[model samples]
Structure formats: structure tokens, C-alpha cells
Target: MAPEARIKILLKNGATALCAGLVALSSFSLGAEAARRHYRGHHHHIPQVPAAPPRALPYPQLPLPFEISGAQYLPLAWTDVKGWSDDNHLAAYKTFRASCKSINGQTGASEPKALGGSLSEPCRVAKTLELSDDAKAKTFFEDNFAPLRISRLGEPDGFVTGYYEPVLEGSRTQTDVFNVPVYRRPSNLFVRGYKQDSVSLPNKGPVYRKIGRRKLVPYYDRGEIEDGKIAGRGLEIAWLKDPTDLLFAQIQGSARIKFDDGGVVRLNYDAYNGYPYTAVGRVLIERGIVPKEEMSMQRIREWMAQNPDGAKELRRQNRSYIFFREVNLSDKDEAVGAQGIPLTAGRSIAVDKALHVYGTPFFIEGELPIDSERSKTPFHRLMIAQDTGSAIIGPARADLYFGAGQEAGRVSGRLRHPMHFVMLVPKGLDPSVRAAKLPVPDPRPSEKIAKLFPQTDPAKAGTPAAAAAPGKNETVATAGPVPLPVPRPAIEPAREPRRPVKNRSHRQQ
Candidate 1:
């Protein structure tokens, strides 16, 4: 009697407890965070501030009262790009298909011309992007845009009319991280490789007198300086997974000194002097700077030391140092511990001005992959709308900031690719923006040289020679006499003129 009755009693008690628990759980917040998370990206994009420079410039270390008098910041003068200006990125097409369903109001498909000739994320047929209702915009953004521009950077058509502010996660002396949900996906790659990998600042004290400037200090020229030894003027590009220690080593010209006991160690001096918001790391593996099938950090040290002749600074001409601020632990004097950037040093992303205006959202499509090992792609990037770098003087060019520290260094250094970009300009804004003013066309070389050379100077130039026969290229010799329009016979002149010898013969006969 007790066993059968016990089972029935237990069942009754279990049912009552379950009912009580359900009553408690239902009273809590109703998907409050989950419901509103999608709207986080609306108010994040900030237009260029009054304090922001016209062009994002790299910060370099110079001596006290750094007399950079002759230094001139180059302006954006880009003009042409071969492809991707219209519909180059593959992603733009996909974005339109995904976003158009909701944005079209009535759904079918739009003609390609309506898409503004691009394939950016949330690429509603450029014709169909009219935001008549909230539902369409939300749906169009959700499918294509959320992945690229919505939560990343650049104010996609209507994010800011909603409420949100970027949340910074560090103090002034620390590396501040501003996190946003909406960001752009890169499409076109307009990387300008430095003609030479690096250059040094020209110390002009000695040469100043020659140029009629007496009060000169150390200076660099974007064009010309008399001194040949001063090095380069701007940022040098290198790929690295971790650039912290490497940066320190570069400035110090020595390897990072780790203790034999495998504990903490430090260097004595401002190894980071002149470099701001930048961190150093021992990046020897990822960049292929030191090639190896399987090399450890220790082996990397050995390789650098053994090959002391190896690229010590690994510097190049025409490339400059990209500077940012870093937060260092107070254990050492001015030793940067974590690199945080308030302002990045290059204008890697920009609007076509003629197409997508500044502050417009875009998605870039290309093959340069992001490393999930350190950071992943779907970069969730932002376009500050800053202008070109000195290296990016060409109109169709973009100076991609590899970012600060080692991880960014690696991604940036390895970032050699051809890409196409697609973006949304502020709707109704004219795509005919004459943003980057005009320049006279480059002169034809033959005409330019004709005026300058006047049939002299050996007809020499930097141009390559012609194919002499097939596969052979010895420069054509132009030393022979100019060919004549008509042939001239090589006959000797007659010595005597017609004479009166016949008159003398008549008298003698």
C-alpha cells in the first residue's frame, strides 16, 4: 500500500513546483536587449571635425622644437582607377539582392542601371533605395548591409536619425577602443606601393645656404632636397603579425633583451621615442620577413643575428613611418605597454566624391584576406573621409592604414590586391561632386622632350628599348645620319668648266 501511494504523492508535488517556477520567469524583461540590439549602429558616424586635418598625416619623432619648416603635407590629387569605380566588387551585387526585397516597397527585381553600377552590401537597386517606410529600410539593411556597413563605419543612408553613440573603453593614457556594430566591408584596393620602400628626413643645415634660406633646420621634401643622405620622408610598409617588439628593435637597432631566466626584462632608453600610439612586438613568423618552414621566435633571433647584414631596419625609400599613440605600463619610463590609437595615420578608405560622397557607407570586394588567427575579416571597418596621404597623391588611390601594432602591420603589409568598391552615397546628393579639383593633363613625352632636348642629349630616357628582333631588347641605335626623303647620288664634282678650245683649233688649222 505504501509504495503505490508514494509514487502518486511525488507526482502531485512535482507539478505544483513547475507551475510556480513558470510564474516567476514570465515576469522578467521581455527580450529587452535582444530586441534593441539591431538598432545600435544608427548614430555612430561622425563627420570630419574642425580639428581633423585635411589629410591624415603620419606622426614621426623629431628633436626638441622640431623645426620642420620646409615640410609640406601633400594633398589628395587622385583621378583615375582602372576598374571597380562603378560595379567592381562582387559583394555589391549580392548586397542589392538581399536588401532590395524590403527596400523596393513592392518586390520584384530592379534593373541593373538602378543599382548605381556597383555591388556594395545593402546595395538596393540604387534606384530603389527610397526609404518610404521603416519596415523596408530595416529589412533591406538586415540581409545585405548588417554584415558590412550597418554596424561598422560610414553613415549608411539613415543610421543616425536613430539613437546611439560610440562607446570608448579606455582612459586618456590608455588605448581607447571605440566599438561600433555597423562598419564597412572593403571592396576596391587602391594600394600605392612606395617607389622605394623607405626614405629619411633631410638634415638641411649644411645645404640651406645654397638655397638662400639661412634660418633652416632639419627638413624633408615631398619633392627635392639637396642632401642625398637624409633618407626618406614618409611611412614605410611592412607586413608583420606582431610589430611591437619589432618596432622597438627597429628604433633601438638591437634585439629585445629577454632574461635567461625567462622572466620580465626591460630596455633602457626611449626605444619608443618619437613613435606615438604604436606598440612593438616580436613578429617574425607571419610576415615572411624571415622565411622558414618551421621557425620559432628564438630561431628568428638567430636568423637576424647570423645575418646581421639582413635588413636591419628593413626600411625602404618613399615610405614613411605611420605613427599612433600607445599606453605604456608605468613600470618603466615612457615604455608603451599597449598601443591605442586616437587618430589613425592614413586615409586608406575614402569616397569617390563623384560617386559615393564622404561619410557614405560602402563594401569593398577583393582577395586580400583577413587573418582569423589574430583578427578576422568582415573587418567591420570605418571611413573617416580623410583625404589622401603623400603616397596616395593619385586620384584613384587610397592609402590604407595597416593600423598600429603587429597584427595590423602584418595584414597591411600583406595587403597587395586589386579590388572594387560599392557604396551608398547620401540619397539625392549629386554624384557629380567636383571634389578633387582639376589638373592639366600630363604632356606627351615626345613633345615635352622635343621642347627640352632639341634633337640632342643622345635621345636617352627612362623608357625601355624596343624588341630588336623577337625576345631581344638592345636599345635601337639612333646614332646614324637622319634618313633622307629622297636618295642623293655620291658623285664627285666636275673639275673644269666648258672651254673655248674649239676657237684655238680653227686658227691653228
Candidate 2:
């Protein structure tokens, strides 16, 4: 009787406890739902779902200024090049032959690695061959080499501008009419190449010029020079009537100065203060001083004349400054380029020397200004790279020489258009083939990732994560990397030893 009663009592107590627990759990669930609904009603802006973490992207590759300047070459057939046959190759040959002298003179390990030894044989052939006409000269080039289109990485077309030797009327001494003074290179200025953390200025690479030896400081800018910073140092080369003419002469880097008498003096670029060149035309456009469509040298000059008050300040906005040395005005002297060779009027071109060889030939086909107003003129000529300029930065970029004098200045100023440039590479030296020989950087981003985060264990980092499947061989073309064109030193013509000038202000006309 006692066993049956105890079992029944235990079953009843367990049922009651289970029902109470279930009721408590239901009440808690209901309260939580009500609280969540109340919070949502009160806070209307907050999102209900939590945001996911952002995925990490691969670290980008950043190259130094030098690494990017590598010349990227793409090969093309001779027939593929436009207007190849019709060009006056005799003119190009004459210029090329002149360049050969410079090429032949360079010996030992100092030769340009880009051209290798290919230029030697072609240069020998150029010296002896006297082509009677353009037809024979064209045949010589066709037999010697193939054409390869050159460009910087990621960019397609190269820009070609025009530069000319400007002629100006001036006097040897400062008078009321001729007061502006041109300075010579300062003796104290020193250039320091690339530094990891620049000692003097921000991001100061290899091209920064400093002042003084005891206490090195940044060199004087254009404004300082105009303000008479180096005025008393006996640096005056010549004095001109118009300060604008002086500025233009500085920009051009060379000028023929006609004295009041029959005599003339040729001034060539010597050195520069380290500040980078900022285009004055760009400043005018930005300040709304002149409309972009009407922006030309003549137009800019007119605007400056009209705005007399702001002219000096406008010119000062460009920080770059150029110094000059006296060059002989002989028939053979002509206007020499940066390569120290006599520049042929129509045949010589100034290219990015950092990315190209001195004697390299490029066939440029673009519309130029042949007429007075400079509307449009067909230009398809083979240009020899005999010169270089600071602004000429890219692989395909070039500055075409348009001879000397005022008319040449007018035509040259009008040429600021894009052109198709094809480089005449020596025969058998294909750029693609040459590029294949060079080393390629690791393409796998993960390999770089390990390098970026060296603290992580190699075992934990896993095998080099690739962009493709495992064991797949991927090849990257190292022909040329994209380069940021850092400006070079001022273009200075090699001149004869400096001689004492006869100081005569009263002897002039």
C-alpha cells in the first residue's frame, strides 16, 4: 500500500515543476519580443541587421621616379608606319650622319645600354654614304633598321611641342631704353641627387640645387632673381629693352642678341635655380586673365601689356629660372642642342633624354602651322633626337626645332599638338625580344603581401597566393614600367672659355 502511493506522488510533483518551467520560458520570450519591437518603434534610423566586415584589398605597387622612366617599346612593321616612304630621308640622313660623329666618339662602358652596339655599324655606313637624293637616303634607312613605336606605360600617344632660337635686339650695357639684365650661373649653387629623406626641402630628389657650402639652403627661385638676389655678383650677361623678351629668351634657353651696332652675341643656357617650372599660360588660364582658346605667346604678351599692374606678379608665379653663357655666333656654331652637337633646323628634335638615346631618330606625323595665322599644315618628317628639354618628359614626347628668328618663333609657338611618334630602332634589336631578356617582377600579390607584413610567420602566411590557379605559369612583360618624369638639370651649351667682355656703354649707337 505504501509503494504505490509514493510513486503516484513523485509523478505529480515532476509534472507541476515541468509546467512551471515551460510557463517561465514562454513569459521571458514574449517580453524579449515586446522590448525589441518597442526599440524599433522608438529608434527609426538604426538598421536591424549588423554590417559585415570589409574585405582587405591587395597593397598597390608604388615605384620610385627612376623606375618609372624605363622606355617601353612596342614593335611595328615598316609598312605599318604612316607616310614612311614619302618622307625626305636625305634630310634625316644628313642629321643622322651628324649624330653618328657623337655616337662614334662614345666608347667603352659609357655607351647607352638601350641601343647596345647596334649603332656602331649603322654609324660607319652613314659616314661614307653620300646620297644624291631623298630616294637613295630612304633606301639606306630601309636596309638598316625597323621602326618601333615608343610610349610610356599606360599612355598611348606622346605630345610634341616646338622650340626655336629667338632673336632679340639688345645692348651690352644698361641704358634708359635697355635696362633689363640677364644673369650668369651663380658659383655657389649646388645640386644634390635623390635622398630618402631630403635634408633641405620636401620630396627633394636628385635635381635639387642648394645655395652656399657652409650652410646649405634651397636655391633662389624666379621671384628672388627678379628681385635682384644675384644682381651685384657680376653675373649680367646682357641687358635688353623689354623684360618680356628676357623672360622668353630664358624659356627658350638660347637667343641671338643684336647689339645697337652691327655686332651680335649668342647666349646659351648654362644652369638654373632648382625650383620646378610652372607654366605661366596655365596660371593665366586658372586666374581667368585670358581665355584658353586665345592662349598663345603673342596673346599672352598682349594680355601682360594690357594688365601692367599684375604682369610682374604673373611672371613670378613660375618659379623656374634659367642662366646663360656666351656662345659663339659662327656659321658652324648654329644653335646647338643639349647633346653638344649643332642642331639642324628642321631635322633636330629634343626628346626625353632620360628615356631615349641622344642620336635616336623618330618619325613624327602631325599637323603643323606652315601659314601666317597658323591654321593647319601637314607635317610628316623624320626627326633626329639631338636635344633635350626639362618639359619633354615621356618616352614619345619631343620638342621639334624650328630654326632661328621671329618667323620661326611664330611657327614654333603654334605647335602644341599631339603627334604620332615612331622610333627607328636599329635592325635585329627588337624591343619585345630585348624586354623578354630582362627580369620580370613577381606578379603574385600575396608574395608582395608577405613582404609588406613581415611580422607574420611564413608557415601561417601559406604558399604565395596567386591571381590564378596553382602551378599556372604567368609571365609579365617588363619592357618598360610607367615613369613619372622628374625634371632634369638646366640645358647648358658647351662653350669656349669665358673671355673678358669690353665694357662700352657710350660706344653703342
Instruction: Give the CA lDDT, 0 to 100, for residue 45 in model 2.
Output: 57
Which candidate number maximizes TM-score?
Answer: 2
Model 2, 325-382: lDDT tens per residue? 7877646758977777788988999876666778888999867666754477778889
lDDT of 1 at 350: 25
User: Highest lDDT, which number?
Assistant: 2
Candidate 2: where are CA atoms >4 Å away?
A: 1-71, 111-113, 116-118, 193-214, 372-374, 433-509
Task: Give the deviation of candidate 1 from the true structure as CA RMSD.
Answer: 40.8
lDDT of candidate 2 at residue 44, scale 0 to 100: 70
Q: What TM-score does each of the candidates earn?
A: 0.26, 0.68
Clashes found in each candidate (C-alpha, N, C closer than 3 A): 55, 3
CA displacement after TM-score superposition, residue 423 of candidate 1 (Å):
5.1
Q: Give the range where candidate 1 is weakest over 10 consecutive residues by summed lDDT.
A: 159-168
